[model samples]
Structures are given as structure tokens and as C-alpha cells.
Target: MQVCNVCREQTPKYKCPTCKIRYCSVGCYKKHKDSCLPVQPPEPSGPEVKPASSSAVCTDPWSVEDLLNEDDIIDKVPVEKLQLLGRSDQLRDLLRNPHLRQLLRSVDAADSKEDAMKAAMQEPLFVEFSDCCLNIVEDGTAPTHT
Candidate 1:
């Protein structure tokens, strides 16, 4: 699954027509247009380029899934490591993780960034996850996948 070209949050459900890259929202789309990168074509596995059969063409209207890019995870200059954290499932197995969920909920509930961030720091799971994330950085190791 591909992440948003800008925020790298949810799986992309929209594509910018100009660049044909997937972005999650109108805000992200706006942010992306100015810094769009060149498209990368799939590598050729054999000697020559081949033509697609006529059956490959579709007449159906585009849907959200049509915007799904098969590029796996994103790690580009514009996307932050903090935004990449939720996209990674390295802490999904931590029990009592609902507090982290609450932290996320509180971000929407709280009136300001300081309040939401303070609430996150108070979450046991978030604290533990932070320790793990930092440890990975300190040790120069990739985050463990579950």
C-alpha cells in the first residue's frame, strides 16, 4: 500500500492529476504540486519494452481505490520521521496501547498542540514507544517489525 505523497499518513485515496502521484487530502495535494518529483517507471525485467494487451484498458469510472499506488511505504525529504512513526507498526503489539489511542484522540479533543503533546507524553504506551524509537536511533538499527 502507498502512503500519502505529502503527509504519509493514511493510504492515499486521491491523486494529483498533474503529477499523478497519490496524496491523502486537498491540503496535502496543494502542498505537493510545487515540489512534485519526476515519475519513476517500473524497471524492465527483460530485453525489450512490450505493449499491453487491449484487455488491460478499463472503462470504469475512477474510485478512491483507483488512487492506490503500489509503492509500499514512503520515506521522502518532505515527510517527517514523526509522521512515519504511526505508519510503521513497530509498536502495535504493546498491550495497554489504548492510551496511545487516547493520545491521538486527545489531539483532536485538545484545544492546542501543547495540550495534545503533553497528553501524549503522559501515556504509558507512548512513553514506552518513544523509548523504543529512540533506542533504535541510538543503536543505529532499523525499527523492529511485527
Candidate 2:
């Protein structure tokens, strides 16, 4: 459990949207917000080389790698395989569905993610979305729809 960045006491239940700093309560947030600074990406160590793949260039400083590293899942999936997700037409098509998007948001925001995922699995659209992503990442090919 992460302690509040501001109070350094209680376990944090919320993260500041701007800086992504954890805080326990409204009071801690109020105290921290004024001094909060958005995290900047580390500067390149060498001469900047343009990415070979368009999908490799992220407009935001934060990338999927950062999120995966935070969750400690970076090693489970190769960066190459993860990049296939962006190139997947089937996955992109699935993401176009609003209901699937809502399910994804619910899963991401839920207090109990396991329970939320279990519920999401009950929906065929969500299952299809998951399968699409898996197919792309695992095989580097989109699932062909009939």
C-alpha cells in the first residue's frame, strides 16, 4: 500500500490527475495540489533517432511501457509483441464500440479489478476485445473476421 505523498501517513486512496501523486484525503490533496508538478520524461542519453515504426512514437511523455513498468508486467510481454497491439485493425475496430469502451473504463476504475474483470468477461463484446488484443499480441496478427 502506498502512503500519501503529502501526509506521509495514511494509505493513499486517490492520485492527483495532474502529477499522479498519491494522497489519502481531501486535506492532503489541498495541501499537495499547489506544489504538484507534472512528471517529465527522462532526456535521451544519445542522439535522437526517429522511430522506425509510426506506432512507436508516442505523443505523450508517458507510454504503455511506463504503465506496464508500474504494474511490473513489462517483462511478461515483449515490447515488440506489445507494439503489435497498435497495428491491429481488429483490436482498433473493437475499441470503436462505446459499450466496450465503457467496460474498459469500468475495469480500469474499479476498486476491485478482479471482480470488475470477471463481470466484464460476461459481456461478449468485452471478451471479443480481449481476444482481439491477445491475438494481436501473441501472434502479431489480427484475428480474421468472417
Cα lDDT of model 2 by residue, 62-111, tens digit: 44544544533223677788887877767778888999999999987786
Highest lDDT against the true fold, candidate: 2
**Model 1 Cα lDDT, one tens digit per residue, 1-146:** 67787898878766665457777877897888789765675788889844597776553334345434345244222235444444445655553467666666776556565567776888677788778666544444446565
Candidate 1: list runs displaced more than 4 Å. 1-90, 143-146
TM-score of each: 0.32, 0.48
Model 2 Cα shift for residue 18 (angstroms): 24
After superposition on all C-alphas, the RMSD of every candidate to the true structure, in Å, is 13.7, 9.7
Instruction: Candidate 2: list runs displaced more than 4 Å.
Output: 1-75, 143-146
Clashing pairs in 2: none
Q: Give the TM-score of candidate 2.
A: 0.48
